[model samples]
Target: KEKVQAETFIKLVLLYNYRVERIKQFTNVTMGASTKEADIIVYNDDTCTKPHIVIECKNETISELEFLQAINQASAYAYALSGTIKYIWITTKSKNEYFLIDKDNNIKQSIPDIPQFGINKIQKYKYVYGGREQNQEAKKDKIKQQFFELETISEKDLINRFKQAHNSLWEGGKLDPSEAFDELDKLIFCKIWDEKIPRQKGEPYNFQIFKEPLPKNATKEQLLDIENKQTNDLFNRIITLYNQGKKEDPEVFKDNIRLSPQKVKTVVTYLESINLNITDLDSKGKAFETFMGSYFRGDFGQFFTPRNIVKFIVNSLPIDYKDKVLDTSCGSGGFLLYALNKIRLKADVFYKKDEIKHYKYWHDFASNNLFGIEISEKIARTAKMNMILHEAGHTNVISSDGLLQDIEIQKNSGNKEFKYNHFDYIITNPPFGSNVKQSEKPYLENYILGHKNINWLDPSKNECRDNQSTEILFIEQCYNFLKVGGILAIVLPDGILTNSSLQYVRNNIENWFRIIAIVSMPQTAFSPTGAGVKSSVMFLRKWNIQTTDKYKLIKQTLQEQIKKESCLKRKNRVSARSIEQPYPRDAFSN
Candidate 1:
């Protein structure tokens, strides 16, 4: 893409009447220990003795930080060259920055544009508005400028931009890492919102920097003030855009932009040019996931499930548009998003020719069928933002404990979709190694697995335990959320399956669900997330009402028959012992 950008810029230079022979692409220059390739180097004449300008072309989706790095790189190339290069031009397809370099004095100043071929004098800016309506006096000298439209970028580039923007906010601990992530999410939301706004082809975006024309004799102080004001104005626009998004979907974020004006500007600079609304759903979703995965793996790894595992679980399920799906411990919404993607791919097959129908088919599922619950408020918001980036399904993701009662979850989350036996599929990797104490959570008593000394044959003997491992309770919770015959794909520690002490848990699972499949995962499966426990992905189908009732009746009848048989045996043994003992005691003594 950078090579393509370079070629395109060369065409623009040629339009200014520069000779093709004088322009060189991939010109190598030595910078100390190694050589670097300059994207484009322009010479004053065909002789190519004097290097006039050094131009660096980058992909249009390049982040502001990368663009600046490119600028420095271009400068280094200029200094390395034997000839004195007077100007430096750095450009992406959508943005351009020009600089005037003084090598002897080691000074570089911002200039609107480098001079065109054969024009000894530089203008305040090149490519000014040139038509009958605007700047008529400069028509003869200035070239007509076209506005840049937002471009869709590749997933790799999008991820880089997200990471760069996030790093800039918290590089020096300006804000906590988690706080930085939140702020970055807010800015990205604003960027997407800005892209969705209706606009004509040539209109500029509200999120980008637009410097007003300044006086040629403007003082340094005056210039500083103008730049500061521009930053402030851009910050205000971001806030306005964020507010508008919040108004439409208030669940995405509850907090306002807390970064200083300058910090907000830094983030906006990276994202302002990309058209996130039109970017491929898979690309955007994965980009956000990758960016989030790296950050979360540091301090919040417990909340996140690896994408490979998430994909595996989602793919294994027979999910469709009509099925209401859920991730009880939906850390960053990995399962829900993957489920959404699955439906989207299905939509592509059925509605290949009809875009409108295709959109509705999958979008309806995202809007209505997908649901998630996250205990951490911050991670829940992250999950909501993750859904929003995927384009829908955010409203149903709630911040509350997955094991909470339906009413409590609904009340706490302000989303009424959570209910027992509601979801068609429950897919999640519930957090492991954590225990939910009966004292800490009153809802623990509500879970069958939460009890101690449970009698598989009788419910009356079940007593609530003081504490239960979370993974144990999540199984019951997933069962509660799933409808009869609903599918459940969950990740569990292997201890639950192999440990002798947890046979009761295994029994409870049998009572609740019919085992579908248990896939053994390697020890390293969760190592990336800082968990070393061996685990397995278990697929189960909940029992229907009739099946459950019939099983209970049969179990009760079998228990009664076994008890009767035991009683008869005991009576027979006692009769035999009494006859044999009397003969040995009283008769033998006589």
Candidate 2:
């Protein structure tokens, strides 16, 4: 039964300190995705419509799961109203939690307490049951200072902590290599979700694996038992939150956690204190990338491209909020993360103080517009987790081969956008020099360059070429993904550009794309990935067919010139080679 009116909690909570005139339990406010009742809406002024803080009330004895559900409801109400709401609070007689919405609409939850009546002044309340509100403004400042200090986890320690966790899994024989990574990924995802969700007053923090401290004198068996119980409970809660997340947004998480009780314990111990979601973006990327690098090398080094080069290439391109971007061979999703960051930077500059109004745009672009495909199941899960850390949902990162786009799309017939010709930009550093061969008949038949037929224009030829490397086929795959005039920034081996043997690959690119610029990457750029091969980042735009019409007009003009000056133009006859070769270089820049 409902025990109290929403206004009762407000009077008990906000009116105790805040100006009573500024608070209201508005009825039937319709500002969000759907029409629903917002329990308690607080205003900054008498206008009442200027929502500064929104609260959703529940009875004091609600279950943790119900409290978490109320949190999602509160977040939706805050987002639905006018974009001025700075804080969203959920409270009961016994439970209280607060959240601050940043300029970019990133809701950082579980802030120490609510803000006071004035600007920059936070209200400090002892979350203890039956405790009185602390009166000293100086005491409130001290608690606020502590809240700010929580995000100060050192980058080096964070990376080391991940490394330690990964080492524990690798050392123990509890799971296979790939299985270990995937299980660890599920746990990490759960940890992030756990931090943001609201908990009952007595319930432990979601990520804190142990409910109580272990005794120092406990034996190994006792310790293992404790770990096993805590880990299973933690993952159980994680799965609940994950299922809830998937319901709210269908594509947020893909796989379920499949770790054994022992292995889950091994990983959770090393990660208990570290907060994956609240850490700085750079720190998160570096820590995760470092962990990925250690595991992904030797056989799969190409997936771990240097972040510096990714940043350089992404910076070179001109990407906007409107363009839908993809990485066909996204290893751990470095390019997509950098691209999302670029959009956020532009939003920060353009919207300034009102960025929260447009925060939904950037958020949508990250989750919906940005896409990636990774072949390795383990790496795909890692990439998804990486995107989640960057505030982008990983629903679009297909875990199939980059070249198997058609077959994958056919199988996933329900997901229509899974097909080709959808992305506006593609940036990737495909696996090169590994000499990995593609032999699958169906997959091989789909590639234009998978066959030795020098003329892809000759549709009559159906012979499949043997031993085609994936990197070579990826060039064609990227071409297929891009719309007309869409840009591509890809890392290519130096041999493909200069070796006469691979000139056909260059010719195929020449025909399909107008090369915009070529910047040679140092041999050492990929050395860490066990790839010392020389490579370069090439920027190119797909050749629009409409431009061919202009070229045809130019060809006609050239033919006329050949007829007028027989002596000078006779040497250069109006042949196919003569018409196509000289026109592109002179027309398009280097």
Whose TM-score is greatest here?
1
For the record, the alpha-carbon RMSD of candidate 1 to the native fold, in angstroms, is 5.3
Model 1, 265-381: lDDT tens digits are 767656766778879888998899999999988888898888899889899989989999999998888899889989999988998735899999999999999999888888888
Q: Give the TM-score of each candidate.
A: 0.81, 0.62
- Choose the strongest candidate by lDDT: 1
In order, candidate lDDTs are 0.81, 0.68
TM-score, prediction 1: 0.81
Candidate 1 — which pairs collide? Answer: none
Badly placed stretches (over 4 Å) of model 2 are 1-152, 172-178, 200-203, 209-263, 297-299, 353-355, 405-407, 433-439, 453-462, 546-590
lDDT of 1: 0.81
Model 2 worst lDDT run, 10 consecutive residues? 125-134
For model 1, the stretches where C-alpha displacement exceeds 4 angstroms are 1-53, 56-87, 90-142, 172-174, 454-459, 556-590
